[model samples]
Target: MDPNQRPDDERLSAWLDGELDSAATAEVDAWLREHPEDAARVRLWAADRDALRARLAPLADEPVPEAWHTLVRDGGRSAAPAPAPRRGLPLAWAAGLLLAGGVLGGLVGAGVVWNSPELQVALQARGWARPSPLAWTHRAAMAHAVYAPEVRHPVEVNVAQGSAAEQRAQEEHLARWLSKRLDMPVKLFDLRAHGFELVGGRLLPDAAGPSAQLMYQNSGGQRVTVYLRRPEAGADTAFRYQRDGELGLFYWTEDGFGCALVGNLPKERLLALAEAVYKQVEDGIVRTPDGGASRPDSLQPAGGRPAS
Candidate 1:
């Protein structure tokens, strides 16, 4: 393979899995070195692959289930066997079903799922099935982990830059630009009451389409991020909280919108901030042209108190 020749998707995927020969590998490696965009995309593929493996690794050593055995032996005629009567069976079955659907390399490389009735059933039985919105919530967490620690260039659009007038202009621009990109109304929530102010936001890739991340900081320099995207039709709307080591997240869906707040603050404090955001969202508070928060005419109730 010529090192200068651009490799196709198949060749790049093979290189990712280490299935390419030394010559092919060298060619692909050289290509990636010269193409930073391709290199970054491959890095995302690697991250997704590692995440999937980590999530399913616990089930690898478990015994194959009797239900799976019966299903394999009886072809497609076997009644959906009982949910495997073991801890790891659900994930194991999921892995098997995914593998049986298509080549694993292609599936992971494309960042997609092999949807089927049986696969859906298996995933739903274990509360593992969800629409793309739920999947991107994990991406929200990853985005926070990657960007929150930066000393500079923490956000793509820095609302904190320049004079107060310039900062306000940036805030409005962030809101309008994200709303346009996501095809949903994006508001810059007022978290100053909870000791956080808008630092800015950036567009992000989601499972379905583009999402947005708004970064905020407190007087003490502690940072938190809010992630927003348009919810898919029939997405789960339940409010959920999750913790990964020291990071705490509060995520929910409402009125065709998905939002997740991620931070390393204590759960109680993070919950307070999340609640503040929820309240502002519920009230339809948006930044006005004069650099103050107010509700739109459609959202303002008769004699309703103005947003603080």
Candidate 2:
């Protein structure tokens, strides 16, 4: 297979579901080894599938409702006498009814009901059916969990891979490549001021599009990740914090960009780091290619405060 030829979503999904033959599986495995973004997306899909299955597993063991059995036995006809067919009903009305039935069936199969607030909350709590802004924040957290623990291959582009000059060049390239792909400014945030140094970054997939994750490590080997993505139109720009088990996340939207910092650090420590990032971004401080900082004139000040 050509290196540049990528598998489509159906192929990847098939690979995830174990629907592919051994040869095709091997090919997908090899391709995933070279493409972290696609691997991440597939992993997320698997996680969702597993979570959904686990959530609904008990229901599978429960006896079917009597009403459902009756409905099935009746071939889905109501117990009440079928109203006399209206002979004058238009074909368009029949088509519309078919479309509505199809849509309703899909919603039911997916466990969604317009009036089921509790069910909707349950789904959102498991990181499903979130609005655009919250959805990407969840992805940021997932990316951090997936990559932050790796010892040797945490990032696709390792800034610490070479000499001083080469490392600087790598940092520049990481910033540039991510910025280009994200269509937003990507800053190699100077976290050394807070005891963390850049370890490089990688591109990841977001719900809407591409996203980037920059990893940083402290002297104690503790790592945190900064996730960046272009903001969806009308996304809320307020600073917010969320906790997912042991991970603490600080996320916000600023200057047409969405940023989230995720780590296993204490809330205070993570907030300090998030504040540092916020300050640098608000000041428009872009880390230069030659290991320096420059504020582009195009950038203007933006105001926001962390949510209490």
Candidate 3:
């Protein structure tokens, strides 16, 4: 098949799910080899599917509730119609619900982990103090996928052009403007040591509020994006990793900021970049060679925001 006529995402997702027959799988493999981006996306979807399965796997082993057992033993009749057995796993339905409503949705609500002892145990085992921020992480990957491929207008602020002084000014303006808008410090991380340079950045509207997206590129033209937003208050801060098809994401929250690095680079390479951004953000300063800070005089016009 012609590369331009590559299969749509449904076919790619089906391939990841092992739903395709051998010939179809082989076709997908050929297409992926020719189109790295699509392959990466499929990998991410597979990773996410696996992670979801792992998180919910324990639910499958929990025995049907006594209420359910009573109903079953009584030939599907009951003196009082017992509410849906919270203790029973209903694994298949739950997985479908997660896929439909979202992974974190319908799993827990308010202070109730569905009022299931088994589910509570599973949550504890999973180290979930609250609903996972997985839904937001998915959004981050989507944002990267949508914007990183653009040949032009990949960023709102064009900081790579103009004279040296003008470029510095633009960078400063970008940092300060995003910082002000986001209500937190936004630092422009320099990744040149790792063979990536600042391309520019854009403002994005997030589900929670305004967010920032910084784009970078290597000499080979491979692009990566850094997504930043204020995390939900009291959210977990542990670093996490997820991949779909060709894209990999390393996301974490710290000091009220949620950050995700999305790229098609190998894990080690992406980790290097993630670590660089993490360290820079933790340090809370982005310095120039002169050891003096530069600030932008005004905010540049912003491109339209992408969906969260």
The better candidate by TM-score, 2 or 3, is 2
TM-score of each: 0.56, 0.59, 0.53
Candidate 1 positional error at 34, Å: 13
Q: Model 3, which residues run further than 4 Å from truth?
A: 1-134, 287-308
In model 3, state the lDDT of residue 278. Answer: 73
lDDT of 2 by residue, 172-207 (tens): 789889989988777788887788888999998887
For 1-308, candidate 1 gives per-residue lDDT tens digits of 76667888778888998889998888888898787557666765565555445444444555666776786788846865475365545555667555544355466677554345554455445444343435767778777766776665688899887988898789878888998999888888888778787889999988878999999999999999999988888877777787643467898887658899999888888888887877777776765535468887644321222122
Q: Candidate 3 at 289: error in angstroms?
A: 8.0
lDDT of 2 at 182: 88
Off by over 4 Å in 1: 1-134, 288-291, 298-308
List, residue by residue over 1-308, the lDDT tens digit for candidate 3: 45468887667766666679998888888888777667656654544454455565555555555775576689988999766644424434343345454443222312234455655554455443333435677677766776786665678897888887888888888988999999987888878788888888989888878999999999999999999998997877778787743578888887668899999889888888888777665544464523343334332222222112
Ranking by TM-score: 2, 1, 3
Better of 2 and 3 by lDDT: 2
For each candidate in the order shown, give its overall lDDT on alpha carbons: 0.73, 0.73, 0.69
Could you tell me which 10 consecutive residues in candidate 1 have the lowest summed lDDT?
A: 299-308
